[model samples]
Target chain A: MEKETHQNIESIIEAGKMNELRKLLIGLSHEELERLQKLLNDPHEFSNEISSLLPYAIRKMVERGEISVDSLLPFVEESMHKSIQKNPQKLADILFPVMGPAIRKAVSEDLKRMIASINASLESGFSFRSLKWRLQAFTSRRSYAEIVMANSYLYHISNVFLIHKDSGILLHEASAPESKALEADLIASMLTAIRDFVQDSFSNAEKGTLDEIQFGSLKILIEQGPYAVLAVVAEGQPPADYRVTLMETIEAIHFNLGLELEKFDGDTEYFKLADKFLQQCLIKQKKEKKQKAPYQLIFLLLLLIAGVGYFVLINYENKANFKRFITELEATPGYHISSSRMSFNKIYLKGLVDPLAEPVEEIMKRFQKIEPGTLQASFEGYLSTEPEILQRRAGLLLSPPEGVEMKIENNRLIISGTAAADWEQNLELKIAAIAGITGFDISGLNKKITDLQWIIPSIERHRFLFDINVVKLDSLQQIQFDSLVQAAVFLDAYNQLYSRNMAIYVRSYTNRNGNVAANERVATARAEGFITLLENAGVKKALLKSQVLFAEDLRETVSLRTVHFSVFDNKPISR
Target chain B: MIKKKIAMLGAFAVGKTSLVQQYVHSIFSDKYQTTIGVKIDQKQITVADQDITLMLWDLYGDDDFMKMKPTYLIGASGYILVADGTRSETIEVALQLQEMAAATTNNAPFLLIINKSDLSETWEIAPETILRMQQKGWIVLLTSAKKNLMVEEAFQKLASLMLNPY
Candidate 1:
């Protein structure tokens, strides 16, 4: 009974302490008592309870605008990154349905832009406006295309780029038709680097920015945003509202793609949607100008065509003239063309020409196609066989004296009219030398035969009688001697004028009464004495020859012993 | 196509341009070296079946006229530190440029090239020094731009590293 009372006392004290704890917790709210009960139980039960109300609590926080999305953005990006890293193929599979159409649209758009630009360029070619633009380009030292763009448009946005601000990476690019495209990646990075360099050199980058970069007529307008930068490569001056457009574009990009920009890696596939916004910035306005006909181009074309046609006509005329000249040369007997050519509008001819043929210069004078100082000719002299040429040659060679006429008929030379004895003597020999004359006819010529023809025979028939061994001219008739000397001189003169060789021979005959040797000596002396007398009388000694002959007449006749005279021609006579 | 910006950093007259000329164009000129502040060149290479366009920024050597501009290396994906094998002091300048590159490019991938290896007989950099650099987890290659030795291999190696960074 005593031990039971002691135990009861300890239990009572414990109960009293619990009672005191229970009384201390009595003032707590029901939620506090339940939290304390849960704290004393399994830890998983607390998790389960919090999880059940977590969505509601977050909703309340978000609805009340008490939660900062910025604070949660990093976690969401990290989770998505982890998901993609876990299985990249899953994201790729999700995007596969739209990729084909997107790529096709991009390619078709590029092709269309190229075609349109090509058409525009072709249409503007050789136009008056294009010519003016070309002139402006030349004076200003700019490209024709650039000048055309500058003059045709009031302002043109050629290219637009959406670049990541921090990494200097190009996210998207847009351009107008035929805009000069550069390596956007490199340009973006270099642009960023240059901006950074300038900002670092001048002031902090956060305070101010590079608003514009002007080079010639091109202006690189930059609009900065929180995550991306919008750059416009504009030709000509853009209006103030253009900047407003850029600002709005950048703002829209940032607002729409804030989260994506924050988590942007090297993958730009998502930014491709930004092309539409960029394309909107590729704005252009044309300058109003009067439409004028391309008179200058038309005139230039007409001038070119006319010039070419004139050159062709002149060439054809020259060729025809050359052909006619060659025909004329071929037809004429004395002219033979070895070579004929035209160069630099000049005609050159090389041929053989007979001296008797018609002059080539005379033929050239007939055609105005041949210009003076533009004809070069080389010719070799030659004899011709034509009848006309032969007649002219015969006339030139014979050179008949006055009152003498010569003509060629049937390749035969016909002489008609009076001719001197020496002239007639040379006609037959000269006719043989002419190429085309078969023979000569002198039947119609009234031959003078000169007074020498009769005088020479009369002198030859009458010989001077010399004494048997006297060797003297004492018995010679003075009148007859003088007549003989006159006839000899006249014959020598005729021989010299007609290129003839004629001589008078004096023969002495000795009687048989003397010995043969004595007779020969007497005959030689008699002939030499006669020659001396003739030479002293003004007759040429060369015209007289001395000869000796012993008569075989035993009768010793006086006629045979007398000296004799004869005439002989030294040259062979053809007639 | 993936594009990466690479920077060439070195001391003056260290064969950086020569190595680039050899690797990119496979040509060499014996004319005197001309100083240029910066030059940009591009070449396409294939690594692991992926095409990559490398934009090479050949910066002026670190010297008094124009010290290395950190701004030039802002978007560089990798860099190559070139030093003349005949000059030991150039290694220090290359190291200094490497530090600047690291600071500006967030410690991007890089390679150390001891150039003019054809003149190894006249090298002032000892083998021990190169061994030290190698031991410090740096990829070092000996190249002779004059001989076209290891130029292609060096660029390809850097491209691969850039494509698949550690």
Candidate 2:
């Protein structure tokens, strides 16, 4: 029963408020309406004060795909324009920090895109400069990027400005962070003036704006829009498509801000987002320049020319230096050059210096700059002034037969050995040319004696010794024995040269410390051992003999306390 | 990563190039060889958790032959002064070259490597010489390119020296 009474009261209240709600609010104060008016004018005030309500509204719009980055760009621009229009002067100052980096970023990205396009065009396909690069890349089997990096020029947009197309007024500007600030208005005005002058002076046939101007390393690129113009100061050779970017930005501005700009006044506040738009067009970059490729090639070419020049110069210098070194060596006497090579960077030498010449130290002092490794030298065994050296040189120069041996004594060379032919006629002339060789002797030399007799005095004088009072050989004595055997074999071979048997004699002696009979016995055993040794070493048994002797009382070393020899020959002539 | 140039200095045939080849290529050659020019090689390694690339310069040995090219020593962060253990004078040469290398790198870290350790019996460099070098506060190592002894360690010590100077 109470629930029915409450339902009737709710219906009567709802029915009364539906008609009275609008009438009751319409009767409020002006301040309340003004408050509502402010809320309507700036939705941010209401939504922001309510916090997450604004986010929720945007989220709902986003969920329904009612908002996008592109669609929001215009709105953001509009809001910034409204705020900037409220106070142009302070707004510009206030926006400086925020817009500075933004403009730089935009300009940097646009420049990079343009540079990439240009570099791609240069490296991807073929053109004049690129053609040359491609041919080199083909020859070197390298990639186009390498060739481009090597030969291509790097470029950068140092500064960019957006100016009112007709007024040449600076609307917005951006520059590299470290770049010095330029008078944007002055540059824009100058460019506008130049453009106007060019159009007036040369546009009689067709109407076109000045597109580019150059000053040494700087270039000004211009792109005209219906409402504004973009003047870019580039430090290097920017890509041609850089103008395409400027034109696109201008077209975007025209599409988004054309209506407001058309009703333009002197106010720049409506273009508050221009800095952001300009920044979106920036770019900067540089490539590695080894400076090596072209320089190395050029250096190689120069090296080729210089190589020949150096060769000629060095040839003359080498000849002169050769002469000087030879002259100095000859003037000092007794220095002989075996080999030498003189070059610009280095000089190589090998020679023999006689003691009769300057001291090696003195010779080396002349070559203070040359290191020891380059100046190779040794002492000379013979000087040309010596008779032995004279004879030797003559012998070598004359090349006498094997049997011909030359001996020099007291300035006279004795060429007494036999020769294949009596080349004495030529020998006299050759020998006379050799200094210190005053005369010749050809007497003792016989040409092929059908019967020959030879004696080896040095081999004969060799002693084959024994240990004290003992005939058994020790290790030291055995060494002498083996040597003796070897000598005997050589002697026998030499004797065979004349078809003769070399006689081997072993005369043994004892020091006076032992009894005469015992010593004689020991001496005899030592001589017999020597005979056995020679026989074993291939000496003819018929050629061996032994003799025992006695020596005065003086103890001798074991090696010298025995029989020595005197070798001679008996001939069986092969001739 | 930082690139530090390290030069090899010593007398002729003292195994400077061999040390570099062993360290870089991980291979040793028994044959003794010499170089006439600066041979540059690169290796990447980590020291104290920092990546570093070593630009090794194998220059020709200096002695009775050519003088060491001072230009090659320029910009070096460190150096390896090698000497033949079989040749005592090579130690003196290494010391002298160290002075030269020092001038170029402003006395950067260096190691005195007495190379040819495989032929210890033939060593003519006196123990006193090595002791003297050590006494002078020089870091000394006995290396054998033939046996690859201490080759990698020598390079690592130098790398660490470059990373943390003093």
Candidate 3:
């Protein structure tokens, strides 16, 4: 039977009849059947089973702390780095959305910080502290901004040096970006020397190393490790926790680089790794204060506005005054403004001006709104034909005497006064040559008559004596009549000298020794004879007129015949 | 680049400071030598395509008035023992300073520089003494601070020895 079963099984296996075999072992070995099932899966079935269990396996591993995120970070970073290196565009596309706001946020933060710093500095710019900082900057050979930040910050580590304890050599150094670079190698050695010097001098320092060294505003904080020392050069007051950070950094260096520090031997190549720790100590914190309102800027702005307003107001007034001055000049009789402009706080004018015109300085003095010496004027001299100028010109040239008055009216020169004869003659000669005078009138003038009036009195005083019955002249009477003729000749000469026509009268007087008719007739005959004699003595016959008059006093006193000569001016010229 | 501290040691008025002045930048004045007993300077030199910076601690001259402090040479990688060629007694002082520096730095590399070689008329050190020192495994060099002769060579040689010590 067994041989028969074996043959069947062999035949079934050879014929690929697994269904019959499954029936054979279905209840006998289920565990073996499950193993066989698992072992007999196809490629697709294997893949599907693994996919189902992968996520759960990973989750379990993560929960149990068997696989850490730290372990996966490098793989992810490496994969991303490779992907970016292969196709940078894809990485850029993925990060674009995040980068835009990130960049904007970072830039805005930096800008806000910068603006705050600028505002703070500007506010302090007017303070006495700012002046002190400026002086310190000059004396310390440092930048003003550096000095300002030095004083403004609450605490700042400018430079951090890692030095070997035994060698006193610089292992590594880190500095703030804004800090000035120093010769760290030299400084490290010098610091070591100073430490050694202190240790040597003070007996109390045997158990302790230098912890702090104060240099004005700068403070050196020294943290000693087993093999190395960390020195931080700081400004302002560092918080107590700052020492903790420095201590931690120094301990980390000693722990991580213990073997290297022990074997330093002036070779700093290995200590470069300590820079990361050293840089962590270059910390800073700014002082906090309320944001003050920008009053100084506002004040400056107001002052600028007030200054500009004052300048503009002054400019406007000056312009108006300049216009008024130009107008005044134009309206004047002898000034003409051709070009006018303002430059350099000055008014420049070019034009023509009559010599007799009102002075420009006098006009300028009237406008106090304009600055002194601000009027630069260039004027060419010109003769003006205006009436007022012409009148002035006539006065200047003629120099009329005190009593004489000259005026210009309707282009005519009118003169009126009592002038000397010579001056009157001069007026007649020069009046026509004056420019702008169409005509002249001197009709109101009078010439003073000097010696002509005296002639009348002298002529009247000459008298001739004649007998009552004798109409003929005797020798003595002829001599007396000659005297009367001479006096008559003097009157005629004066009349000619003065260019006047006057009448010389000859009169006869009779006494009471004769009858009235006979005396009158005799007197008339005597005057007629006297006139004939005066006329014959070179006096004009027309100028010598005869008259007979009875003398009452002489008629009562004595019977004497008298002939008198007198002269009267036809047109008397006042002296 | 490598940095090393080197000391200049000798008797008073031995031209040790003058040698450093010729070969390095003296940021600290000579007054520092009188006050602090040491003036520090630095110089950069190239040897065998390697750049090295030497921190020179010019110690105040050893004399009865101001003896050099061994603390200044605590960390020096090398030293230059200077002697005035015009004074034979400075050679004995230089040898004494060498022993002190050796004790301080554990026999660090050094060079014996006979300075003021240009003052030949006043030179009092015998050449046979220099030969005797050289025979005793001392690297001896003649230098002139005034003429700047062998000043650079002496520093360059010292820097090379410091970088690649025997």
Off by over 4 Å in 3: A1-80, A83-108, A121-132, A139-141, A203-205, A265-272, A290-575, B25-35, B64-69
lDDT of 1 at A387: 75
Model 2 ranges off by over 4 Å: A1-138, A147-575, B30-33, B69-71, B102-105
lDDT of each: 0.82, 0.71, 0.81
Quick one: best TM-score, which candidate? 3
lDDT of 1 by residue, A364-478 (tens): 7877777768889899998787777887888788887888888888888898997666677766777798777888788899854455668568668777776576655553477
Tens-digit lDDT string for candidate 3 (A417-502): 87655577767669888877889998987664345555567667776677665556678777766766665665565566576777
lDDT of 2 at A240: 71
After superposing candidate 1, which stretches have Cα over 4 Å from the reference? A1-126, A134-145, A203-207, A259-265, A290-575, B32-37
- Tens digits of per-residue lDDT, candidate 2, A151-177, equal 544776768887766534456688755
Poorest 10 consecutive residues of model 1 chain B by lDDT?
Answer: B32-41
Lowest lDDT sum, 10 consecutive residues, model 3 chain A, at: A551-560
Model 2 residue A515 lDDT?
74
Ranking of models by DockQ = 3, 1, 2
